[model samples]
Target: MLRSTGKHSFTKSTVIFSLVCLLGIALTVDVFWATRSSSSSSVYSSIASNWPREESHVVVLPKAANDTDSEETVDDKANRVPQRLLSATFADIPAPELEWEQMPSAPVPRLDGSAVQIKDLLYVFSGYGTLDYVHSHVDIYNFTDNTWSGRLEAPKDMANSHLGVATDGRYVYVVAGQSGPQCRTPPTSNTFVLDTETEKWERFAPLPAPRYAPATQIWKGRLHVMGGSKENRHTPGTDHWSIAVKDGKAIEKEWRNETPVPRGGPHRACVAVGDELYVIGGQEGDFMPKPGSPNYKCSRRNEVVYGDVYMLDSEMKWTVLAPMPKPNSHIECSWFLWNNSIIIMGGTTEKHPVNKRMILVGEVFRFQLDTKQWSVIGRLPYRVKTTLAAFWDGWMYFTSGQRDRGPDNPQPKKVVREMWRTKLKL
Candidate 1:
């Protein structure tokens, strides 16, 4: 009878242990299933909610008609609808309200040049053409007639690329750019002045340092050139120089050195509004140490591009502005002072393979000079780099840029002859 009791007790203990183990296993499975379901549901919800909204915002170009009759019809109403849509969107945005309208192309394909609007006419000068050669011809486009005409050639030895251009009401100054052989050594120090009134080009005082890709702006009636690569193609400098223009010539006074940029690199784009100058987007290096000494081998160090924005105040103080959304290099950024806000536009992001991965942004951002806040504007018609932009009569004209291919085989080909005039609602 005692042995029977002991066996029953052992069976009872075994049953209780099995029940506990089963309960724990069930709880574990329930927790895991709950977690996985919650995670997947959240992901799907986010993706579904986000995707359509983005798609809706995209502006699709109207389809081109192939037949002559269709072409004529489309041309009559081609950009009319797009302009209306853009105008409606701008009504909601506050100061510097804007609209975009496509314009006819210049006479020839050009990029990496300088453009200035004098009176009702826009002049583009000295840029890289479809071929590798630097262009000397000046092209004039009249907004009144909606026609384009080629003008006199730039002065001999004045043909250049990557030059800094600024207009002081009468003439456009082309300063310090690359002229000789492709992808070769140092660029030229030659500076050329284009007289908009005369349709003639003349030489100016040479820069102390021969540089390319320098940031330039007209401040207080003086032209300033800052932060460009010198000697070593990859090594950019922090030097700053200024030339005061008087009677249509750059004064012979020595370049006054200003405060060096904390982080020095190439200055790809710049804009001057009022008394402030904003410089944006370039690369910084990190040198590797050479063997045996503290000296370093000149390889492309950090090789990192930036979206950093720097503003030089009227008092010549440098202040950091809000950074760009992403890293970009070799941009052609400028500020269009509309109402009280400045509109920034037309720049390239970091280099990537193909046109897809590597994006050329047409998105315009408005920077309120007083508030220091950035707001998004309408996008551009297409991708462009090293383009020239000018603001006139409440419209922004963007012209002459190279269309990027891809990274696997990047080509500096694809020159654009198209011109786009985006009217602002300010």
Candidate 2:
């Protein structure tokens, strides 16, 4: 009878142990499902809701475990990165308000300085400093740091002033520009390439001829240099030259003069969009002519500001586009290409020789290439000229340029160190 009792006890103990193990497993699974349900529901709710006003980014959620629908396959998930956040599902997010936001001032005040961006960094090259002082220092602004952390010196032979500048993401090519104690006295053909990674400048073959305020663009792996102030005058020539490159370096010091542009003007702004080069606003006619010069009869003290527009195709052909509504003499200002349109910001008009001051205009004009139309987008807070403009990640940045309050002050201030920027969403 005792033996029978022991067997029964053993069976009972075994049954209890099994029940406890099953109960623990069930509890563990219940906790896991509960946590997952709560977390996934929260994530979906946040993603489904409208994006916050101040939020500029969104975290994409992983696919749900049960999302095995044939229509929404794995390939769809792999292909959609930007669309996942910026698609119509997030349409409630308001477009960025278009306005100029002042960024941190550059370490050194400069005007007529050329600017270029590689990745997240912005580099400002040589320009006119205080009291019309010429500079060869390169000031770099780090977007990550939100500050100018370092400065690099240009090559000793670099003559920078309204010089043609271009970058192929690694090397910055500084082309012919004027450099002298006095403004616009001498132009140099010296070409200097700055390796951004090394912060060092190396000399390249000089331009065929010296050019000041010329427009430069890297098109089809070659440097296309166009109109600018030549020699001792503001005469713009139709010379268009291309410098070939191989393995990220200039192949030769010689420039192959391509088909000349349809027209010539000093200080024209040129930008490359795909295979086409768009040229805009320049000072065409000579402002000052000698007594025996051909243009002496029509030449005035100030060059004629133009609102003309032209496009150069891949075939080396030029096409004239709709002219600007108003002529601008700020020939050195930078222009932005966005949404198949061109945006021209602050630049100066003709100079007042009697007053010895130029009329600085803060007007912003946009050109729609498709419609061949013009519209006034907005205006800068103050009139500035000789400023350089660069676009990166949908933001337009204007670096320090000279600003003359003209008429308000007989002796107007010459330069402004303020850097202004605005969103391109508008």
Which regions of candidate 1 deviate over 4 angstroms?
A: 1-101, 284-303, 333-335, 353-358, 404-413
TM-scores for every predicted model: 0.67, 0.69
Best by TM-score: 2
Clashing pairs in 1: 97-425, 286-302, 353-407, 354-406, 354-407
RMSD of 1: 13.8
Error of 2 at 362 (Å): 0.7
lDDT against the true structure, per candidate, is 0.65, 0.71
Residue-level lDDT of model 1, residues 157-246, one tens digit each, is 763666777777788878787664244345677887777777767878888888776777778867788776665556777888886777
